[model samples]
Target: MPNLELLRIVDSIARDKNISRDQIYTDIEQAVASALRKHFNTEDTTEFTVAIDRQTGDISATRNGQAVPLTLLGRIAAQTAKQVLIQLLRQDERGSIYEEFKDRVGTIVTGTVARFDGPIMFVTVGRAECIMPRSEQIPGEEHQVGQRIQALVREVRDTPGGVRIILSRSHPDMVRRLFEREVPEVGEHTIELKALAREPGHRTKIAVSSIDSKVDAVGACVGVRGSRIKNIVDELGGEKIDIVRWNESSQIFISNALKPAEVAEVSLCFELGRATVVVAEDQLSLAIGKRGQNVRLAAKLTGWDIDILTPAEFKAGVDRLDQTLKSVPGVTQEMCDKIVALGLINVFDIEEVGAEPLVEEVGMDADLARRVVERCTEEAKVVAAEQEAKKAAQALAAAEAASAPPQRDARDEAVLAALGLTPGRDPLEKLAQAAGDDAGAEPAGNDETAKLPDPRQAVPGGAPETTVHKEQPVSSADTELSPEEQAVSLPDSGRKAGAAVEHTEETNADTAALAEGRAEPPASPGR
Candidate 1:
């Protein structure tokens, strides 16, 4: 039998290897219980402990507070079982590395390339071995054995075969971690990274802002002259870095997130998770980037669909679209095209009778269409009226320009003479007669002649001069009155006092002649 000192030495070895003494005792107890069950065909109701004496080289098995009877051969065989005990202790010491790092999934960690199993790169991260699959490694970068690399812990799983840890270097979080390590503010919570978007080994955009007013968020991440970001870039195989300022407003954030491109306008539709960004004509290429990488990353970072357009392209598109719409069925080519370009393409879409669509359609907004329709209709009316006026004016000008210096027609002399006007006399006389004016020729400064209203005033193209009333106040007021009142006022106003006295003999002679012509006044004249 082994001495008690040997047992003590074994316990010391187990303790040194971080194995507990109670664990060792428990193992032996289970072994004893198993052995007794096999040998005796009976389950023991009592528990047992393997004890050693320091003074004597004696081994004792106590059951229910008493020692068990055993031969020297059995005792010697059990005492010689130190190698078996050590084997069991070693099994207990093997802890799973996967279990240690499983909680670290979705975070960044450093690892060494352990080996490659065909396409998969086996990496050792701390206590466990994680795998960086071919899909997760940075393209064109080789992972040599024992090469140190930082990667994102993507997943962890345990199967019957063994524990598996999946890793990635292409993940956006990988870049985030690099920034956290290189920038102290990130780790200290002074600067927070709101989102990350990465094109592994190509370019990465990180949206970061500062919780502290004192800290310059982008400045700290970029370091001085971009030293900090440069370090991270070098680690990522010279991947490009874009540090965008974070904004609370998503529109502003997306605008910043799509950096390296100048944005002219950013329109956000949060309900649809979309943003339409309009850039200058020159900035289109930059906003879309080489093969649209910039906008792609911006989409991932902002979690929104980004539609990019150049101002000129958008406008031209709007124009061409409107032109096409003018050709729609049931629409005049010009009107349809105008309204379509205005963004109303369908009959139901016609917001107004003219160029505006009635409802908000895909291309046209309601209010804009309403205004456009009003403007177009109004403009069309003005244009039509102006066209008529221009034709008339041109005709009139042609007639005036074609006239032969106003030589009077000899045939019209009879009519002018009846109206007390001469053929080659004042043009006003011919015009007044042609316009059906009953009043005689206007005398210079004579209120009666000047007050003569123009008959052309009732018709278009009549004399514009007669259309304007003469300055004689009483003539206009008397003309506005009833014929009865006018008749009453005219006689008194028409005769001058001296004219009446001078014309009395002629007036009586005229009356006597009318009486002689009509009645017995002829007999009185004979007597």
Candidate 2:
């Protein structure tokens, strides 16, 4: 009856903990064996086996295959067995938690806030608790104990304490998974989330596409009258979301990326992967957003370096770039016209694509290709010089205008070190420093002659044919022989093309040229 009761307890634990019955039974058996070893002080040498009968629930223990009376294990062994069983069960529970959550990483899970350990918070996720590290938490968002929340499972690991499941609210996938949860079309594979850029707790820019033509990707994600997306926004503590339509054309995609402000035109430098976005003067502030956040997020979303500008500003910048490009010496008027025709109107654009665009794509000559790349390389240095000069002029103006100091970024310090002037120091020093930088940045040789074509195997039109020959030894006797008889003494007979080798004919004297070391005449019997 006691054995049946023990079996019943095992069954109950197996069902409640979602652990296998065999696993529970095995743990119980090991616990009994462990208790026997502890009580008998034979943990190392003596072996003990414990088993439970499947049908009758009869339990038994043996020492070296011999039966041991149950009475031998007193209250002391029973207490030890119970303690061991609890420990083993806890271990099994932890193992179960790890196995359950390991595959669940990069997915959303709900949990009640369990407790806090310093900056880290613990949330009860079903059978186990997950940790939300300080870095993974949403910035400025507070959590209270017993509050239910959904978080993305960022990581799960086995640690000394047990299975540690790391949860995250700031992960980009959290928003993606939330959309998958709320928007049935996303989960149903009708609408696909293409690219996601998030500044968690601030804003998120998601590019989504639709597989079905009838289904509007952005509309479906937004739901009917913004009901579906509103739920996600609320859950994220009112963090703003921009849902952009994914397009095959990057220009269109980038145009879509800078939404809510409306883009007037997008000028793309494909080689450099940069897009100069032009917006109306009125829309400029909206396009740039507060502290350039909108443009910054748009850049992140499109994976392109974005520069926002007004129409006038863009044209002025274009004119400046075109002037800087012409500074490349060896650049002729015709070549410059061809370069503009080929869409390389700026120096950085040419530098980005290298000489390949001019030669291969635009069909420029090989010599011109090398010259163009060199010109662009030099032009880049010139542009940098002009920018530095402009910066110095601005600094001088600022010094003359007011006594207020300017704030600078820490990363700028490393760059400023090379300038020989600190941020707030003298503007006069910067003029010399800028000149020095330009001098050092110049190519080793005169920019025009510095870059030359590599040794070419295939010249334009075609390469000349090359002839191969090996040296042959001649005897002194051959040189002493008559021109006609030189062949017999030559040890080999040879004929030349287009020349008669008439044997009657004074032994075909052309052969003797070898003996005299003179040029061989053209002749052959086959002619």
Model 1 agreement with the true structure over 302-398: per-residue lDDT tens digits = 9998988777755654454454344333334554444444433222223234432234333455554555555445544654587799999999999
Which candidate number maximizes TM-score? 2
Model 2 lDDT tens row, 1-527:
55678678878998778788888888888888888888887865358888877656777999999998767888888999899899989999888888888899999889999999999999998888788999999999999999999999999899988888889999999999999999999999899999999998999999999999999999999999999999999999999999999999877998888888989988766656678788999999988888888889989988999988888966765675556546656555666666555545466777778887677656777786777677767877887799899999999998877876565678676667676566666556787788888988945633334243355744778656554332234555565667776655434434332223344354545567666878575678888
lDDT of 1 at 525: 57
Off by over 4 Å in 2: 44-46, 320-345, 396-527
lDDT of 2 at 127: 80
Best candidate, lDDT? 2
Worst 10 residues of 1 by lDDT: 343-352
